[model samples]
Target chain A: MPEIIRFGDRGILVNFEQKIEAEINEQVIRLSEDLLHQHGDSLLYTIPAYCSLTIQYDPKRTNFKALSGSITSLLNRTTSPATSSHRKIEVPVCYDTTFGLDMVEVCANKGINSATLITEHTKPTYRVYMLGFLPGFVYMGKLSQSLWCTRRRDPRLLVPPQSVAIAGAQTGIYPSEAPGGWNIIGRTPLPLIQPDAEEPFLFKAGDLVNFKAISLQEYHEIEEQVKTGIYNLKVSYGF
Target chain B: MASSHLALYFAKPGLFTTIQDKGRFGFQAFGVPTSGALDQAAADLANQLVGNGLDQPLLEVTLMGPKIQFQGNGMIAITGADLSATLNGDRLAVNQGIEVADGDILQFGRPVSGCRAYLSVRGKWIIPTWLSSRSAITQNGKHLTPASIVQKGTTIRIDTSLVDPLRSSSAAIHPPETDPGIRVLPGPEFDRFSRFSIGEFFSRLYRISPDSNRMGYRLQERLSSFSPEEELISSGIIPGTIQITSSGQPIILLADAQTTGGYYRIANVVSQDLDILAQLKPGDTLRFSLTSFEEFS
Candidate 1:
């Protein structure tokens, strides 16, 4: 049984095993979806992390004892993973020197060329674990051991929006300009967040992402098309 | 138009002024930070004094306050910190509703007690909202990276003609707490640290570091040499979580804190005491007092 602890006065934290395995996150996400569906009226929000799910509820509406009891019952009923729609998204990345700020340093450290870096970086169909640190920033992971690299020694004060960066086993695209310590290897022209849209974020947790390398010319072309709202991202749903 | 009758013409925008309300909820799953007023009580009081709803968007001024000229007549109130506010060369009191005439210039001086002050004008504001919130994500709430800072010469419009008149009398002035110790409950990883480290965390004095901001308050004092036993998987965190870093210093996450973190969460400040911490400025000294969930509620 997962441990359920009180987080502050208004939050309840449901913790799984302290590991980064995909199966644990799957359980966390499943619990989050079930909790939302079952107790949406009482919950203000829920944050699903790698191994835990934190639910913030209204203290005025329901106290901790009642809420935790309901959560425990829900967890007990949950025996199998809930089957839901998942998406396979192919994101286009430009690995040109102009946009990839620390590409050369990363290549030199790994003793590999830019071509090899691109091939290895784009090889995996990464899973979206969780989104945090910034709005719409999707944390995807499980890069090949050969492509794993440490973060930058000196973090950048402001990484440009849509910069695809890697640190340790994790890779993420910055939805907006933010201070980041990750090593930038490529840039994506697609806007990751549109606040006014029906769905603001490009990728939700539990989705699968694949990167496709494109030339700088194609990047600019796609950028312009995106600006005109004519470009369509390669996406397959119901995975 | 009603906009012309109710507006604030800003001649000087003080340090770190932003529009804040109760905050944007149900969006943490999307990695959005809750970028609202740091002090909820003060924000609500300001709105109440101005005859606005409790969740109405109001201006939050940090340290120094703004110099606003009323374009037209409207009821306004200033609460939270007493920044020596003035109206056309006359001293203005906080936590009270006051009427302003056209061309009346309101200015603020040095802070008297607290770090932040809230200002609310009588009416429904005409500000644009992103993701169902009028709160401006200026500093740590940079999820959208919108340059939402209230700059000098900016004008804010309100529909004062539509709202009802103020009915309540002036609110009583509630001063900041004199106590230096913040009450906290043990977190998920409270037992992860050594007994000595845990004792040091509760007993030692910690000053708020200069680098502290809305995201989190970085404490200056470090506990006697200790590091996390193992790397923690990134997990959900709330506003008052106290995460101990590799260097042994503790950081209390605040209003604009990220939804998830990988550091060791030793404790979480109770929700009621969060307002006390919000009024604190940089260089303020504080200690932690362990409390039980039964006592906290």
Candidate 2:
């Protein structure tokens, strides 16, 4: 049974596990999607994380005891054994020295050359485990163990938008210029988040991402097209 | 047009000042945080005094206050911390609504108590609402990031025509001088820390760190450390979540905090006491007290 804990005055947290695991997050996503589909009206918002789902609601609409009752019932229901997405979209990256702010440090720390880092980083198709920290910022993970190292002791005060970064076992793209401590390896020209658009977020949790490297010249071409709103990134059917 | 009737030009943008409302909701699933006024009560009180709905957009001033020049006439109210506000060189009451004429300059003195202040004028604040909120939020709610803090010489328009000041009796809300114990519920990872860490958490008084801002308050003290675990998952975090970092220091997340986090959340401040947390200034000391979950209702 998922542990039901009080999040605050009007929210309940359903934790599926104590540690991070892909399977656990899959369960969390399923539960969140199921509950939202079943009782979204009663919910003010639902935030799904690696191993937990936090449901926030209005006290007037439904108190903790009442909300917990519904959540408990949903928890009793068995989560289907599977993944949320089979499709993987290709993401183009420019790993030039100018774009990769600390490519040397990451290469040295991980004991790999730039070629090996780029090849290994792009070799495996990563999962969109969750989106957090900022709008359109998707956290994907399980970078090869050899690539695993802690985040910077002192985070940069400013990391530009769409900068591809890795920290420890995870990787993410900055949707916007924000403070972060991740090891920057490359940058993408695509706008990963757009608040005013009909669909503000580009990558949803549970999706898969494939990285493709491009030259700096190609990066400029794509960037120019993006500026003119005339470019579209390649996304094909997956898994 | 009503928007033209109210224009604000800042002679001095003291500290951090920006527009805020109840915040954008229903966007957390997309990693967008609800960025609203840190002191909701103060924001509401200021709006109410000006005859505007409590959720309407208003100005939230942090630490220091802004110096504003009005282009037209309107009713206005200032609430929250006693910033010693003035209108056209005359002292303005903290919670009372007053009328202003064109060319009037609204200014503030140093803060007397509390950490934030709210200013509300009659009519809607005319600005683009990104994702249904105007709270210029992001980056720990510190006025440091350019996300929403108003810069000097910027003129902001508001839909306006002065309403007679609400004239209804407005209560002066001076915060209590007594140090408040922030009420909290045990976090999901409450027991994950050593028992000594938990005990130390309750017994110790932590001063707010200088780096603190709207994102979360970084506490000055360290506690018995929690061991590092590999593969910690990134997960949902909310305002009032007291997360302990690897450095053993605790950070109390507030409005504009990251949508999700990976640190161990040791406790959560109750909803009622969030306003108290919002009013905290750097160097101020605080301690936590556990409360029953039932108290949430």
Candidate 3:
């Protein structure tokens, strides 16, 4: 059972566990979905973190006491483990010299050649833990231990859009041009976030992602097609 | 149907200017920051003075102030910061509804007091909203208004049809000139700090750093250092949550703070007192007063 603590007069924080774990994250998402199901009108929204869920409510419509009671009851009812029905997304990356800014530094730090570094980086199917900091900037984690490296001592003033970067045990693609500290390893041309779309961002939490190495030419071709809103990347559960 | 819009052209957009309403809600799960008026009380007062609903979008001016030309006639109210303002060469009154004549140039001079100001018109501005908010310059994938900074060529469309009966009467408030000690409550990781560190936090006067922006206000002084044995996992964060960085300096997250953070949050600023922090410019000195939950609860 999670410990429900008062976040503010209008919010509540449900702490599932103190530490970060995949199971905890899964439970957080599951409980969030359940709460959304149970009290759709009462809650303004719920923020599901790695090990906890924070919910904000309408002060006039619902208070902490009533909302927490419903949440606790919902948690008690849902005993089964999370099904983890997350979709698989395949993203293509071009680690060419022109696009990969920190390739040399990252490869040197990992004590591996460019090809070996690329191979190891693409092998794992990364999970989308949560999207924060920037829109469509997926914070995925558990990068190969050998591939881990310290973050930039001095962050770049501007990192271009679709710049796939890594730092420490995590990796993600910058959805837009912004200042960032992560080490850029490659670039993906896909527009992970479309501001005009009803659902701006492409992926949600628990989505599994696999990066495929593509040629620079292919990256540009996909970029052109994506700009026209006609390109759709291949996503399959079995793959 | 009546168009009910008043368009204004910006000639000078001061240091920073953005459109803000009450706040953007129900999108924190996707990591969207709750972009809103930095000083909610001022914005609300500005809206009320103009006889508009509290949730109406208003211009939030920071530091210096914007120079604008009203394209249509409407009642306008200026509140919060006393940005020395003049409408068509006539000294503008703060916190009072003044009718703007078409083609009248409204310009703000050097800030007389306060760091931010609110400009509320009687009707609505026809700006597009993202994630159910009109607030600007956030990381939440919201498209920046063409002016974004209320640039020279940008024209903001507003509703001028609604006549606020209280248009002639002026409402004014004298914001305190002296530094009012900020009130704060213990944060989630408040227990992790040593008793001495806590004492040091409240005892020392802190200055707002130059690097501060909409995302957060970084304080200049470093607190007593005590590195935690364990890393704080990335968790939910709200505006006014003061998180200490690795260097032991405090950063008070503000209107545009990210929805989640991975730092040890030592305290959170109460909503009522947040305006005091908002009015503080860089190099301004402020001290914290340990406020109990009972006062706020």
Candidate 4:
């Protein structure tokens, strides 16, 4: 079940029945699209989380009761499709010692070999569940049970942009320079957030992500291509 | 730098003064926080006094206002804090427009009440607008740093062409008295806490700590009352959301707070009563009462 909760005078939070359900995440994304289709101008922004969607608006222009009632009605009237037809995006990652700062730490904690951990992490398909904390940072989840580990007790004061990290059951990419507590496992050359780009963010909620391991040399080549605006990774979308 | 326009020189710069407007909206998606005046009542009052639009730019002075001298004839008004004000050595009344001739000085005394004050002029301030807002955010010092307190030699421009004589008049408006009851509504994460913790939250009176600011207000809650092991997933947080951290201290998110947080939110302060919270100074006692939107609307 989808629940609508008031955040403040100008915001409403749509939460799912379960905290980490894939169906609920899809519903949130679909609802976000529906809201944008219906009242995009009225909305200040939509924050899609793991199992919830928070829609912020201008209170002077939008009435909370009417919007919440309308959303509830919409959710009740519609049934979410069994599976979301989303795009599959492949991200090239370099798991070298320098880029993967916590690779040794993760291996020691999981009691697994570096090669085995990398193979398992890259093999599974991950879903983008939320975008938060920073611009263009995607929060995707439910890593292989073996790769799950606790986050650092104290977050790094500054984690460089494009750092791929994992903490517990989730994985994410840093879009900008920000403080982070996640264990960095690899680095990607792609720009998750580009303020000057025509499309600022490459990935949205409900997108499928596949990690392709690349050599250090390939990483440098891609980095140079990205800087020169020549690198173009395949990105296809259906729904 | 010399300009063709007139300038107002500062005689004595008081505590803190910054330019403000209605605030920049629709930019949070770019990770830009909306920065504006802390007290809208004071800002609106000053704007109304000067016959400017309710959303026009104004000076937000903290506690005490800046003492300024006019370079040319201009209409201005003082609102917000009851900081006794004088124009050209003559005491001027609050909420009223006054004309200051060239070389005339305006001084502000210590505040009688209220933490913030507003001053407005008939013509808009000639400062550059960033992200469509003239309001300055201290965090964005690199992009738009706030002007320092108006000093004895500092000068500001006045657009005589935009002045409206019809808007010049002084009206008396008193600030509201401090209220003790702070109303609140149950939050989305309210059920996550133990029943005893919720009871303690409602019954206990929390004092506004000295470490309060535009970002948040840290309150001293009884730590032993609640023991939460669940690490809350970071979620969208808004102004007035009372988030209790791992150490069991309650921090109320405010205007310039981050968009998302990973702490448990016990309750949300009702919108209508947020102004009351904003007016509270350090050492003030606040009692939380559970309520809903229906109580205000």
- Candidate number with greatest lDDT: 1
lDDT of 1 by residue, B167-280 (tens): 784988888866468999999899888898888888898889998878899999887667777768888888899999888889999878888888899999988788889888
DockQ (Cα-based) per candidate?
Answer: 0.70, 0.59, 0.55, 0.27
- Residue B111, candidate 1: alpha-carbon lDDT: 87
Who is ahead in DockQ, 2 or 3? 2
Give the docking tier of candidate 1.
medium
Report the alpha-carbon TM-score of model 1 versus the true structure.
0.96
True contacts kept of 4: 0.29
Instruction: Please give the range of 10 consecutive residues that has the lowest summed lDDT in model 2 chain B.
Output: B139-148
Best by TM-score: 1
- Order the candidate numbers by DockQ, best to worst: 1, 2, 3, 4
Instruction: Write model 3 residue lDDT over B1-297, tens digit each, in one string.
Output: 576668888888778788888877777887777778999988988988888888789998987888898887778889998889899888888888788878999989887788899999888667787777777755633343333346656788876675445533566586755656998878778888999889999988898899998899999999866576666778888778899887789999987888888888888887778888888888888998887766632
Please identify model 2 stretches exceeding 4 Å from their true place.
A78-87, A109-111, B1-4, B140-148, B161-169, B224-231
Write down the lDDT of every candidate, Cα atoms only.
Answer: 0.86, 0.81, 0.81, 0.75
Clashing pairs in 3: B4-B159, B5-B158, B5-B159, B6-B158
How well does candidate 2 score on lDDT at residue A19?
63
> Sorted by TM-score, highest first, which candidate order results?
1, 3, 2, 4
Q: Using TM-score as the measure, name the better of candidate 1 and candidate 4.
A: 1
Could you tell me the lDDT of residue A85 within candidate 2? 49
- Structural similarity to truth (TM-score) of each candidate: 0.96, 0.92, 0.94, 0.78
